[model samples]
Target: MLAKQRYNKILELLDKDGIVHTAELVKLMGVSSETVRKDLEYLDNQGRLSRVHGGAVPVDIGTTPDMPGGYISLQIRNSQHLEQKSAITAKAASMVEEGQIIALDYGSTSQMMALTLKERFHRLTVVTNSIQNALILAENPGITIILTGGVLNRDEYTLVNDFSATLESIHIDIMFMTVTGIDPVVGCTDQRLSEIRIQNQLHQSASRTIVLADSSKFGKASLIKICPFEEIDTIITDGGITPLMEEKIRKTGTRLIIS
Candidate 1:
């Protein structure tokens, strides 16, 4: 196929599946791997998509104003951290117990926790803003999943809206939340205001709040602040977190667990 035609097909596949692996693109376009790489490079340079390891993800121009809400779009842009996210998830899961009610946030790390919980927990109630996490837990008879009703973010597959206000009235045993950035001084931050509202509400409603993040998320602040580190009960992260950063978090009297 012509270069233009091949690139168009690549976009079509990504639009259909939300992600496209380099090998799949090569097969579908009947092109050399180098040709596929160059095509992805060109598209990424144009700011049409973001390149991830072994694949490409569609960019969320909609989040930039003059564009629709792009929560899902941004989530896809950061989907390359699957390995580190899973480690955070495993560590978070170890903190849960049977018969406990928990609130799970909407993020890649939280999704990993849901998957891990499905395999281990026998009797638990899970409330979540993530559609993907809810669906994964739905199949497990050991867990009862409650999905917050509100606006559906197609890109991230999460729900956000006035339903968050309802969370304030109900009590949860624990909340496993995720953030875009964590600074020793600025605390936890997120890119979207809507997400911040929901996360804050979840934190207030739960007896114990645990922030699940990877080392990459540290030292970066986004557009909005969710809550201060002192408000959190604990932080679960990978060992990649810097000692200086960990010291900062520990000083807040919040337990820090490195997996």
Candidate 2:
């Protein structure tokens, strides 16, 4: 496609999705990566789209990236992002379908997601490491909660060590994970290395991996990286996402849902 055609196509995609990926444009326009980058640059320079880490977001989403602090404990995280986490998890929980096996990671956001899952389905088999999540989800008779049988992490209230039992036992339909940080350059990351083993096992076992994080997760790189951003199928976050990170996610073709 010509430059004009590519520009129009990119705008059309942005109109529908609120963001357009550089890689998507490369394929859609049948152009080289350099060509797509130039096209994006042209659009950005014209003030038609806001340039970001990997692609571009609609100029209207306007907000610059904010520097986030280092990792905090569960006590602190619960009080932080209360409303944003609720809204993000609520939207994420909707992706769950009946009779599907769902796996959850340890975090306040994942805990909220487990709670929001209640009454959404008549039958659900949930596997998780969060002790609080297990207790909250147990109230629903429709859900079968499988708390991981492993070492207890008192600080995080999660079980770890041997995750083979959970992974080998069942074929998980969906898995929702929580990370300390996500960056365009470093990808998905976390603070604790101990938790990565179990999470990796979960990711390997599941058919789809959905990351649940608030906008605070953006622009931050944690101590350890669990995996690349592309490894995740979808991200459900709040509106705090900056135009820069939105571009990064779209570049990898991962679905971004800003609540």
Candidate 3:
């Protein structure tokens, strides 16, 4: 594998097991022990993981939006995985029907999905907490945007209010959401606690819940877990997902769609 793929694989392993031994990684990655050590050192320098005695542990990044070197901003995230997210959102948008009441949660991927939906469908009702998503779809006259009213989270560009009551009254045909991580055991997780609750409420309100995540999210676990894979109706991700990671999610009885 290339250095980038190797780096992602190593991070995924760390997210899955919390720790990784250099010897095991050498075997898993089909590289030399020296190569594994160098990879770990590079990741350690990037603050992605903590290098230790003959091994490394996953770092607690993406937990807070304000912490320096820890938080991943929306702009940075939206710019990072452009091609992968484009494919994922295109596939996600194709799954939606015209005039269906859709719920979009706050995230970079969801914003991309909103853009896709606006271009593809002429008539639809979209309920979202993302200020950016609402603004993106507002340009389309045929689409009706419902901004979930709440405390505006400036950093994330999301509304952070209790959505339990609002969602209870509305029926959502489908909800496309994003996650910070997707550890096989931990299922779906995010960095913010408020978003986690809102995501859960949206999941309950929607007739179908489809998670929009790229391959990088697999095997990782964030600060707050939303639900297990079984609870999610489907997961739409890019082709970068590893076979092992795909198998793990499939075993949870959640349908996996590779974009």
Instruction: List the lowest-lDDT window of 10 residues for candidate 3.
Output: 61-70
State each model's C-alpha RMSD to the native. Answer: 8.3, 12.4, 6.1
The clash count of every prediction, one per candidate, is 2, 0, 0
**Winner by TM-score between candidate 2 and candidate 1:** 1
lDDT of 3 by residue, 1-259 (tens): 9999999999987766456778779999899999999999999999998776667765653334423224555665676678999999998888899999999998788988889998999999998888899999998999998877788888888887674467778899998979988988988988776677678778888999999999888887767878888778889999899898888888888899998
Model 1 worst lDDT run, 10 consecutive residues:
62-71
Instruction: Please report, in order, the local distance difference test score of every candidate based on alpha carbons.
Output: 0.80, 0.80, 0.83
Off by over 4 Å in 1: 1-62, 66-79
Please write out the lDDT profile of model 2 over residues 104-210, one tens digit for every residue. Answer: 99988887887788746678999887888898888898899887778888778898887547476678999999998888778888877667888988888899999
- State, as a TM-score between 0 and 1, how close model 1 is to the true structure: 0.73
- Model 2 has an lDDT value of 0.80
Cα shift from native, residue 215, model 1 (Å) = 0.6
lDDT of 3: 0.83
The prediction achieving the highest lDDT against the true structure is 3
Tens digit of per-residue lDDT, candidate 1, span 171-259: 89999988878988898887766566677787888999999888877877666888887788888888888889888888877788888
